[model samples]
Target: MSVTTRVYVARLAGTAVFDPIGDQVGRVRDVVVLVRAKGAPRAVGLVVEVPGRRRVFLPLTRVTSIDQGQVISTGLVNMRRFEQRAMETLVLGELLDRTVRFVDGSGEAVVEDVSMARQRTGDWLVDQLFVRRRPQRVTTLSLRRRGATLTVPVEAVTGLAATTRTQGAARLLEAYEDLRPADLADVLHELGESRRLEVATALDNERLADVLEELPTDDQVEILSGLDRDRAADVLEAMQPDDAADLLHELSDEQTAQLLELMEPEEARDVRRLLEYEDYTAGGLMTTEPVILGPETTIATALAQIRRQDLPPALASMVFVCRPPLETPTGRFLGVAHFQRLLREPPHASVGSILDSDTEPLTPDATLGRVTRLLAAYNLLALPVLDAEKRLLGAVSVDDVLDHILPEDWRESHDERLDEEASRG
Candidate 1:
């Protein structure tokens, strides 16, 4: 590969990787390096995430160019999945944000980025680190500058090898800020257990709740357990009632009750109600927080509510029209007003005027099989679950139904299996 004099590894993240013929293969997720006992780490390969979210190793030898915005390869790529080895370190994932001190004992700095340079023998090595100096304590009232960022030879820093020191995740989190919750969960799943918990703890409650919902049940429980009880309860309150209930199901009854007790009364009540249902039933797969509007709500108001960026696509697909009480277990169920219908109607029209009442709503006791079939038969994204009294209890989204029907370990195994099969082919 034609290497530039120096390339900042962090800047290469998410850059497209292409084959010799110019066909894009995947994107760079991280850099793999072999840390040596006495010198800079040797640049081994790139962690490229291909289609289906399978990350594979692309050795540096196969890379033809590492130009701006893209990395061109020799077209021979291994389709097998990448798994980290014992002696390897992921520069972007592990090194960034590490607390280190200069050899001269001036002060400590946080590793912001690392640069790889071609050696005399033609091998690329991580030779320099871009770091931000930690602010020094000041006793005077005079204004002092914040920590300044600068590049220094990697050998000048200490503490990078110490696993005991607490590492900050700010730089890493900033690098992945654009990733979707599911993608971020995938990234988190690949980290070591301790590191995973560290990053999870760094995220705010709402962001962490979104990521937790996308993670496997085991990961969700582990990260939640790592947090203090109060914060854990707050995160649970932020998650969708059904998802929070599912995660709680994996914990001990005592632990679940404690967290529930700490949650807001109304939020905990919804989760507790969901926990009462059998796992394979519609009630267990539904979220109690779908958009609900009374009969007199106007099309414009309904449109505004559904336009909320926080609503999941399936839950946002339609608004459940009900009577007086709009919350779950709402007063008498009217029907649903699909988003498309609202867009077609005048802003002044009431949602009740254009309801899709023909489609029957499922009872909470309905089987998963029944819910799946009804969704497929109606080509619906979400279906409302009603009580025998015809009050809307919650909405069963298609995504939730799929999550239940899939194998329990599907999140952990699905992509790996796909990559294995591709390699065999």
Candidate 2:
């Protein structure tokens, strides 16, 4: 086995990034990892803040050495602007300073820092954590003694959860950081009523939106009901319109209208459009944020755009081409260019020239069954959904389709499997 180097994720923040030749490049802003359903997530890259320029992604492959408050890299760095996607997890922004549960279910503790390492596999793992335990109850007998800080292995963390239900509980909810939103939602579903509300109340809008999408309609409504009107509106705004609309469709008109009225007009408008469609229709399943491009764009420029956005692997596999005004209900839908085709072509090749226009796009009103069949027939990961005027609206990904087709109790069954694995471990 190869040697490993221990490093704290927090200490790396603000450390200088240097080229192999000893020239300074930037400061580390955050560490990016691909969160998995289990096991430690591999650190894929770093978000570095370059002086006078936008933050950029520095992939781990480019990093030659990391020590002494500096990260040294030997490879040519891509200066493309960095943007987080659905799959990239920010350690400092989302994980550090959060609370986690002990493996033995003894009590909760605040995470002071994450201990990561470059392992024998040549990957960075969140190997350990520095945590400060919370006192069970404040008493005169323990007044002089505060919670003690201890180094604990990541494996000792059972879940990201908490017994305390304060407004600050959200910070404690990070104990479930190892889990994906779907898995976390399942855990939330299984918890006792008060504990469930405490955890739900703690999650910020974005995280809550992710968890809500994975929850059943009834569960979604229950969680939303626990939050104040403003928070409920914010969470709904953070959710994808189709998912938000579906959840809203399950609520009483009075409740739905109240939340909508509290939301920003622009966001509420999008949800309203989705609500107009039947729950099983194409319009109801599509996400408005597909990678859209003009016909005249070159392969090189397209690749840069893809890197800049850091799209989820599946959505990044292809690019949609459209006419001017590249927004939803955009100018007429043109065609699509696969990433593989882009690679095979000259860097200067125009996307229009390589467009695959043979595939039939789905209309917004297409039934779920029809959408599924078309995606399966073409072996497409995502299909464009258009309007009557042939304007591009959104793209329905295969994952979304699978979400609808799965059994109602799928999340529960998956949760049970996860629980069994935890027991074995």
lDDT on C-alpha atoms for all candidate structures: 0.89, 0.77
Off by over 4 Å in 2: 1-174, 307-313, 414-425
lDDT of 2 by residue, 319-425 (tens): 89999898787899988898888989999989999999987899988999999999999988889988889899888888888889998766544433323323100
When summed lDDT is taken over every stretch of 10 residues in candidate 1, the lowest stretch is 416-425
| TM per candidate | 0.94, 0.59
Candidate 2 clashes: the total is 3
Q: In lDDT terms, how accurate is model 2?
A: 0.77
Q: Model 1 over residues 343-423: C-alpha lDDT tens digits?
A: 999999999999999878999899999999999999999999999999999999999998988997776676565456554
